[model samples]
Target: MALEYDLVIIGATAAARVAAIEAVNLQARVALILPHPANGQVHPQSDFYPYALAQIAKTIQTNRGQIQSPSSYPWKYAYTAIDRLEQESSPALLAAMGVDTIFGTGEFCRRPHLAFNINQRYLRARAYLIATGSVSDYPIIPGIQSAGYLTLDRLPSLVEREIPLRWAIIGAESIGVELAQTLAKLGCQVKLIVETEQILPYEDLDFANLIQAQLEADGVRVYLATIVTKVSQENRSKLVVMGDESIDVDEIFIALPDRPFIEPFNLAGVGIDHTDKGISIDNKLRTSHPQIYACGNVCGNVLGGYHSQSLTQYEAKIVVHNALNWRKIKVDYSSYDRLPWAVYTDPPLARVGMTIGAATNSPRRDLIILQKYLKTCPQAILNNITSGFCQIVVTRTGQILGAEIVGQNAPELIQILALAIQQKLKITDLTTFPCLSPSYTEFIYQAAQEWHTYNRNQKQQRQNGWLNCLCWWK
Candidate 1:
């Protein structure tokens, strides 16, 4: 008798774990196949360490020139504290949930009627979900491979070494920006070479500009609109050559987006196609092959953010319900349509839902923009940290469409905006929400109130046509 399952999930990351748990609840026999973490199944703390370093950087900046309990090498904490893939995708937990967990990578077999081969064990299923996630992609510069580099997976080993005195970052994406600021705060001479004209091309220009300004103020040399043509090792230093500039540094970091993990499957052999971004999946999370579904980073451009774990968790819920049940449920990310993300810089950059750029370019011509500078906010003034602002995109009638926020506590404030957007609350509705006398949340209510007052006055002025307009007199 051949071993069979109702559903077989590939990869042992967030989506796989969630799918396994849900499958068991639905009384479906599910098996999760994963490579040993020591091999390649591990989802490294690449995304997480930047955040930890950011917190440490904030502490260092806050206590600078002041007496405080000092940890000489604060950057080491980025390595020491992280949750591993094994702990996250625990075999014992899966066993408790009655999910058979296999240790090894699996591939789609073409011969003998199409089965999946997990090392030597064969697995046949009624349906399948690929959730292998993505891996770090190193930059392609001349001599990059020979010169060597440090990725997130190697951060732990860096803790054992002496703190680097100088560092050079090749990209100014979210990771590059965070790492540059963190390293600079930790006393490293950091030079950031960028490939984009803007620090964060994917984000709203206002938020990206603020973060770039902060990075420069913190003593980071940011080189914009340049590319690294060559990288070489010379006399115990890494040599990075960009247009008209050559930087010699003790360490070089390449912060790029991760590529999907799709090698083992030999996808083309199975008529499954993919781009450099990731595996191609429809809005329903279904692949070209009818019975196969994909979620998480493996689904590619469908989820576009540095840390899309939240989206992955949501996608997993939909995948399990559809992959096993008779009626397929579509994966919908537009419920909130707000991707509230944080950059984890000292004063983090956070935004939820549609951004200013998105709203401005949207076909909706009646959208009104509302702004509140952090300097004017009571909490920002009281806290003595007033270097950012909050922006909201609203319809003429006050329908809340998007929000962008920057500075301390922006992450938390964005959460409120996320909920408001989810509920389809308007700017007028926000104005009615009670806020504490001296709190950060007051920024939202006050901004809405100010806009409402200004809009009302404009309406009244328009109604009093002859008195307000020179055209009437002419």
Candidate 2:
């Protein structure tokens, strides 16, 4: 039988799943095509799965003198979540929502026809959403290929074996930081290398300083402004040579950046525009070909930033609405700027809108900047974690530009700033809003007061200069 769907979504990541659900809700027949073996944290080649399994095995072994088999862990967790959901809701919930799941790789057979190799059978679909996410990308470093290092997708499994006591991680992005911390917690001597002058270069300098301090205190050796020239194996240990420096480690885990996994599917034939970054898409999430849409890692919108799964789902919602209701509505992503995000390291750093540097360098150079120290906040004193502060940027007319927090629960605290920015709320609006006493959020009120005071001083200075000019003219 020829299978046809009003909307077809490729990949099963957060964005793809949300697109499928939203399309179905719009009364469109939806077909979701996933990889033969899902490749993500939730399913197949995820690095975190093995660590989670090992934790479960340890728990079971402690309770019952025998350890649970490692291979059964993924299935065990999958069934547990599915069973719990089914028991709490209806078994046919997914199907009833009009989303049909097809397990296979989806490739373009024609302009509007998508061929899916599902369990060794062929299937086709209509409109398609390319949300294939991404895979780890390895750069062409000298001798590194022959050294056999593991990508972020494969590192979790290697960590589960727990064989490598001495480990070297190349790259200090979010994944590198997480792996370095996780392996250190599991008793591995971790050494992290980054080509940049500082770790988390995309983040604010203050946040990076806090994270670097924490990692060093944890006994993790971080080499910054260094590049890995080559990697080779010697005596069953990985020898990584960075410039003139050589380090021997049991395993070399590459937390290096990833590019979109688009080559295998041969997307060029389908007329999709792509670069080293990934597929190109406009604000509306529409690719060069109007009928085809892209989201998530496959698109370069968020790049290396920690875009929450929730935000990707939101982007997918925009894609679905554009695909289904193109006549009645047009998707706009300008308002999507300044989304809040964070690094999950201890003493987490969260930011929204623009940074002081970003604002100064931006075309909006007329912005007013105000910062309040965490030491001034009551909660920071009580918690003994006065390492960071709250910074807010506003315009002369009191319009909020951006906010950043770099202390405990900074991610949670940044939520209010995100909401304020989204609503285009003025700084004055926050002064009257009731806030809890003795909390980190009180810093917002303090920062607002500082901004007002600075604004008044600037106005008085301007008035005095004008009066002096009038006296000279008289």
Candidate 3:
């Protein structure tokens, strides 16, 4: 006999689990299908490993200056800590929460009716969500496969082993850049190769430049606008050839873009629309089939470039509400623009909405570009960490359009602006909001003060012009 469900979430991704949990909370029967499971259970992977390592390495760099060896910090303990944090999303935990956690691969069928077939059982649901997540996309380079390289997914295995003395990171993605800085701070020589003119192609140039400078300051050799022509093994070292110039390193890491995992689901036979990037979805996040929906990395460009876990979880909530309720709630990221996302770098980089360039070209003619440096903040000055700033784009009347932040607790600080933009709050509101003393958030207050001062000056100039006209009439 075939089983039925309110929703069948395909894949064992974090997004999949979120959708299942959310559906259950809405009083819906949910079946979560895990594509590949060991012993009928799936263990979730931790995305916090790189962030944890980066923080630990930054602390070491601050206290001990240049590390002479990678063993200066306890790398194994960091991995163990991350492992300990994984039980919260375990299959057993989900099952305990009333989710039907099925373990195996599945394919969509369309013969009699749309159904998912796995392990000789058929799953028919009112709606289906594909959240298989993404995998690394390798660039075409000669001898790369034969040379053997590590992707971000395989990087955690090296924590148990000795850190390589030297590394050649092939791409400049956020994860790749984070690991480069971490490895460099841990006393490894890192060579970062970028194919574009800048490191992060999607971010503002100033933001990307700040991170690149920090990477170089941490002793990472950056090669901008460069590509790896080929890769070969030379004795015990790997040779990364870039045109006539070549460098030999102990190991090579590939950090290309990620493509969605959708081939196994047999979407073509089921008449679902998809591409090399990911499945196509409307504003409601519905697939070609109205009964089907997708989210997370599987949705590809749905969230633009902010593909963080938090945003995916947000998408999961939208999918759940729309799947269970009669009235569908559209997936609107923060009301006006994209939600904020951060890169776990030394000083960190957090961004949301329009860049300065985008804001300048906006329909709003009266735009206020408020900027303040962290060097001016007491907390940053006291801590001797003052190499970042906050820049916000707003209308003359105080409507915030976008913001870019790079400084201490930047990721945390940017959220304030994100909420402000979402609620359509004015710049004056930020100026009046009470902040704890000696906090990084004071930078935001200072930037908001600029708008206040500008507004006062404009009012004064208009009053003066009116008085001059009165004198002329008299």
Candidate 4:
């Protein structure tokens, strides 16, 4: 018997779930296939969700907040507030729009379509969404396999494990930083090793330095400009070799970066071109085969370590729209120009838009960069939290080029800047906008005011230069 559907999404990730719901709204039959479990990328085991939700419930109870019943906070809520809404409402929502779910792995049966391999059976669909997402790539250091290390996918499972007193984590990527902090808070001594001179090499140096300070303050031993040559088990503990330095660790985590997860799908048969990054998709999210659409981490356009779940959802919406319309719609990736991302570690580093290095190197050398230390902020002083700084880059016209923040709630604060950048709001506009005083958000306005001052100084310099040139000519 042949199974069929109007649309078949080949992953049960955030993108896949969004695509499925959108297809259903278009009155298309949909089947979502997953090789393993359907839990979202971050919490595969579904354990973190319950723990997070419980914490939130406890916080609400302590505050005597009466928004919703405590029962409303479920394991899914632990993952995301949106996930809770989706779980409680998406099924009925999709069913009302005519979408169904199928659990399995999908393979390319032909071009522009796929055959799902589920429970030893093959199901087919007219159009397919290759939103399988990306997988983390662990380093192949000698004895690494024997010593045993956990990937991002395995971290949730380790939540139940008794984290030993001494832990060494290599790589200072978001996962590494987050895990290091989580473990440290749970009473584990964590030492983070990174090849880069600073943690979060992709972020602005000022922001990175702030995070480094925060990590150190948290009792995490951060080893900058370090390389891991080998991993070995000794004395019932993991021994990590970094040049001449050797460290004994009860648990060693290798937080090496990730690559695209397209190897198993065999895209060669479908005429989709892919590199180590991901499948080659055009701005329209169309693969080599026009009918086949791809999005999320499967598409190479996304910077692997720097993207957030919000950005992935935004991309998924574009892919779904173009797929349903069949009319070529160019995806505007300008959002990433000032894309906001946050490191979940304590004193989180959050940023949107270009860094100082990028701005200085770009063709637009006329741009100006301004920074404000958190120590100077009234709120930070009041809270006794002055570990980070805020930075803003703007053009001569006062248009905000980028913004970066590293401090408490930096992640939450970056969203406003991201919105401003997306809408092409001027720096002056931020200062005039109504915002609550004595809040971290006020930093945005303060930063913009600093930019204005810098802008005036630059203008004065340029005017003086012109007068000097004229005087010389006379």
| All candidates: TM-score | 0.90, 0.81, 0.91, 0.83
Clashes of 4: 1
- Global Cα RMSD, each model: 3.3, 6.0, 3.3, 6.3
Off by over 4 Å in 2: 36-96, 111-126, 158-160, 303-311, 328-331, 362-365, 455-474
In model 2, how large is the Cα lDDT of residue 313?
72
Give the better candidate number (1 or 2) by lDDT: 1
What's the lDDT for residue 313 in model 1? 80
What does candidate 4's lDDT look like per residue over 157-249, in tens digits? Answer: 443444356788888666787767655544457799999988888776766776677678666789999989989999788899999999998
Q: Quote the RMSD, in angstroms, for model 2.
A: 6.0
Could you give candidate 2's per-residue lDDT for residues 175-274 as a string of tens digits?
A: 6875675455444577999988888888777668778888776657899999988888797788999989999988888777667766655577678799
Q: What TM value does model 1 have?
A: 0.90
Tens-place lDDT digits, model 3, residues 111-210: 7889999899899999999888877666689998888888766667787677788899988678888889888877888899999999877788888998
Candidate 4 local lDDT, residue 380: 84
**For each candidate, what is the lDDT?**
0.77, 0.70, 0.82, 0.70
Best-to-worst TM-score order: 3, 1, 4, 2
Best by TM-score: 3
After best superposition, candidate 4 residue 77: deviation in angstroms?
Answer: 11
- The true-structure Cα RMSD of candidate 1 reads 3.3
Model 3 clash tally, residue pairs? 0
| Count of clashing residue pairs in every prediction | 1, 0, 0, 1
Q: Rank the candidates by lDDT, best first.
A: 3, 1, 4, 2
